[model samples]
Target: MTLVLFNKPFGVLSQFTDRGSPTTRATLSDHIDLPGVYPAGRLDRDSEGLLLLTDDGRLQAQIADPRFKLAKTYLVQVEGVPDDAALARLRAGVTLNDGPTRPAEVERIADPALWPRDPPIRVRAHIPDCWLSLTIREGRNRQVRRMTAAVGHPTLRLVRWRIGDWTLADLPPGQHRIIG
Candidate 1:
């Protein structure tokens, strides 16, 4: 089975092809040339970082299926410093419009040393921003963003730092390497 680890840049689609969009956007094909490999899970167009691709259907299922509960970790930058209550809510799991989320491992973290985003996130001089290392066992659409928003600190930037054992270490934006 072929497995590719890609550091997806912001504004890029998780899929290989961009279809029917009014304007052209970067897709996986722009970084990956390996045929038959597909994304195991999606990273939003606005989010950046580690994304896994594999040729094996079984492997894809293992990585993406919430039933398996493979932990996915993210480095999130929120609009304000999350208080003890907000952090506790995240660790205990908060309810989203879709439904309740699985409890996540959450903690405030110093700003991570990472590649500069192409179009940087917005800056607010009046309000403070902070980062968090959040790990969740379930994949819900925009779950991290929604959770933070629910806690009153809207997400400013989101980066998938690790998925199970795989991480983005040493991989630059818009680059991919076959791991297996």
Candidate 2:
């Protein structure tokens, strides 16, 4: 099996092509040139971090399918510091438009040692922001963003730090390494 670990940068689409877009946008083809490899899962265009690509279909299923219950960890920067009550709500799972999310392992964390994001996250002199480390086994559409917003701490930035045993490690943004 051929596995590629890519540190996807912000504003880059998860797919290899941006087929019907009115305007040009960054896509995986800009980073990956390998044939047959496809992203095992997805990260939003605005979110940054570890993205797994593989040529094997079964491996892709194992990584992306929620039925497998592989844990995905994220380092999230939210608009405001979350109190214990907010963190508790996140840990217990909060109801969203789609439905209630599965319980997540959530904790307050210091700002991670990370590469500076280009066009850095907006700053507000009055409203303080904080970071959180969150791990969830389910991947829903914009679930992390929704979860944080649901608890009154909208995410200012989101980074997928790990998926199962795979991690971004020291790989810089917009870079890829062959892992298998």
Candidate 3:
């Protein structure tokens, strides 16, 4: 079975099917040459970073299933500097509409060297910004964004950095590489 590590670019859908859109453009199918492989997990169409695809159902399940405790890390840029208390709240688990999420590993990180998004994030003159490295074991719908919003610092930009043992590393946006 073929296994791939893809650095999904912004504005690209996670699935091969476009669902009948007028602008039928890029997708995982456009970049990944491997056949019979599907995304192990999904990154939002607006977010960019490490995505795993595999033909092996067992491997895909191992990575995507919350029971495996695979960690997914994201570098999030928020509208304001998050205080220690807010960080603590993130680490202690915040209640979302779904329920309280498992406590995440949250810490401030240096701004990574990143390619500019196709449509850049809006910048406000007065509001300060900060970046955080957040690691969560569970895959929840828009969990990171919801967590930040719950803490009063709305996320302006979000980029996934790592999933399990894989990372963004040297892969640029719209790039992909096959790995064990």
Candidate 4:
């Protein structure tokens, strides 16, 4: 079984191919050349970090299926410093338009030493921003972004640092390493 860990860069599609898109975007094919391996889960095009791909279908199912409840951790940079109440809401669970999200492990964290994003997040001279380490078991469509926005602190940047036991570590963006 071939298990590959890819550090997906911002603006790169989770899929291997880019077909019928309105604008040109980078796809997984640009980073991963290993044939037959498919992505186990998806990372949004606008988000960056660890994406696991494998040739084994059972392993892929284990990783992606919500029933397995693999914890996904994200390093989120938000527009403003979130107060205790806002953090409490995230910990308890927030109601989104789709539905109420499962309770998440959320905490304020120091800015992680990460690689610089290509375009960079928008900055305001007066407004204060902060970093948060959030872990959620379920992967919904832009769940992290929505959760932060719901609490009044819009996510400025999102990075998936770990999925289950797998982590990005020092892997630079757009690079893939075969672990097993």
Q: Could you say which candidate leads in lDDT?
A: 2
The worst-scoring run of ten residues by lDDT in candidate 3 lies at 25-34
Candidate 3: where is the Cα deviation over 4 Å? Answer: none
Clashes of each: 0, 0, 0, 0
Runs off by more than 4 Å, candidate 2: none
Tens digit of per-residue lDDT, candidate 1, span 69-115:
99999999999899999999988899999988999999999999998
Residue pairs with backbone atoms closer than 3 Å in model 1 (clashes): none
Q: Relative to the true structure, how large is the alpha-carbon lDDT of every model?
A: 0.95, 0.96, 0.90, 0.95
Candidate 3 pairs with clashing backbones: none
List ranges where model 4 is wrong by over 4 Å. none
Scored by lDDT, model 1 comes in at 0.95
Residue pair clashes in candidate 4:
none
lDDT by residue (9-121, candidate 2, tens digit) is 99999999999999999999999999989999999999999999999999999999999999999999999899999999999999999999999999999889999998699
Two-way TM-score contest, 3 vs 4, winner: 4
**Model 2 clash pairs?**
none
TM-score of each: 0.99, 0.99, 0.96, 0.98
Worst 10 residues of 2 by lDDT: 110-119
